[model samples]
Target: MSKIQAKDVNGVRVLILNRPEKRNAIDLEMYTQLTEYLIQGNSDNDIRAFMIQGQADCFTAGNDLTDFLKHTDIDPQHPAFRFLFTLLDITKPIVAAVAGAAVGIGTTLLLHCDLVYADKSAKFQLPFVHLALVPEAASSLLLAQTVGPKKAAELLLLGDSFDAETANKLNLINDILPSDSLFDFALDQATKLASLPPQALQASRRLMRGNIDGIRLQMHAELEEFSTRLKSDEAKTRFHAFLNKKSHKPT
Candidate 1:
């Protein structure tokens, strides 16, 4: 079965993260799938908008550490980078339904979405500092722009998890819905967007987002730093410690 499941509702392309056992942790393969789906949806005229979701209990646990540990050296062609860049380039409106954990890239990816709806079960964290790495997805630039430098510093520097309510206050989410209804609510919103006049809808979206050249530049800078950090001794130690902790978990 595909880790990233694709479905269509009306004109909306819905992508679901399907690795429930891993709490929907994104691996390289999943990243590639996500990129392909977004690229496909963006180019297909029939697909008016895109919706990203996961199981009601989990949006995503973030990247799979096992994959990260094995593939530390990265470039623009890397699956993770390709996925991030795809999110930036896609012109169609993207709506996200986030239920449980949105960690690392999980949280960063939402910054690019046109709309984000979450549930009380949602938990968000940057954790790049904790992992001895730098932020990617242009989060270092966008987070501060979204929530101010002080708050962004707290989120990125401290590397702690915040609840859905807190995320709402930070303007990270449109609203919090009951977990049972979050998916339907997000889908409804995506369908509404899909129903709108396509050219106008896309044009309005592009205008609202303003220039993305800066975002693209920031992503390239982040990629360079992320690649350097991934090869660092500190990052290696942190990754090892993290994996060791997980392996010793009482399972």
Candidate 2:
């Protein structure tokens, strides 16, 4: 089955992350596909807006650790980097529907979306520090700007999960809704955006995002540190422990 499913709805392109069994953990292939889809959506005149979502139970559990560990060197050309850069460069309006766990990049990517809606049960986390790594996707800079430096430090440093209420309070998510209703609501909002004047909407979006050149620089810096950290002994030990724990879980 396809891990990333794309569909067009009322000029709104909906990309569904469909690996529910793995909690939609993003692997290398998914990264590549996501980047490709975003690039296509941006250039396609028929596609007015984009909405990214996952299964009702999970938005994403973040990177697939096994696949992530297999890639030693992460450069600008890497699929993960391509995805982040594409997300930053996309001029179209983007909306996100988040539920359950939005961990690591799952949470960070929402920072770039024009609008975000989360379910009451949604949990957002950036546990890069716990894995002996630093934040990626320019989240270190964007999160700080969104929630202030101190709260950003508390979230990134402590690497704890925050509920939807906290996410809304920090202005990370626009609103919280019932799990069953979140996806439809986000899609409705995307349709509304799609109905707007495309040129004006994109212009306004670009204005709101401001100068993303600084964000690009931050992403490059974060990728450099993240790649270096991934090769460290601490990271290896943590990855092994995490995999081992998963292996021991009851089937």
Q: lDDT (CA) for every model shown?
A: 0.94, 0.94
Q: Estimate each model's TM-score.
A: 0.99, 0.98
Q: Which ten residues in a row have the lowest lDDT in candidate 2?
A: 72-81
- Candidate 2's displacement at residue 217, Å, is 0.4
- Per residue, candidate 1 scores C-alpha lDDT tens digits across 40-121 of 8899999999999989888898999999889887999999999999999999999999988999989999999999999999
Q: For each candidate in turn, give its C-alpha RMSD to the true structure in angstroms.
A: 0.7, 0.7
Q: List the residue pairs that clash in candidate 1.
A: none
Clashes of each: 0, 0
Error of 1 at 86 (Å): 0.4
Give the 10-residue window scoring lowest on summed lDDT in candidate 1. Answer: 202-211
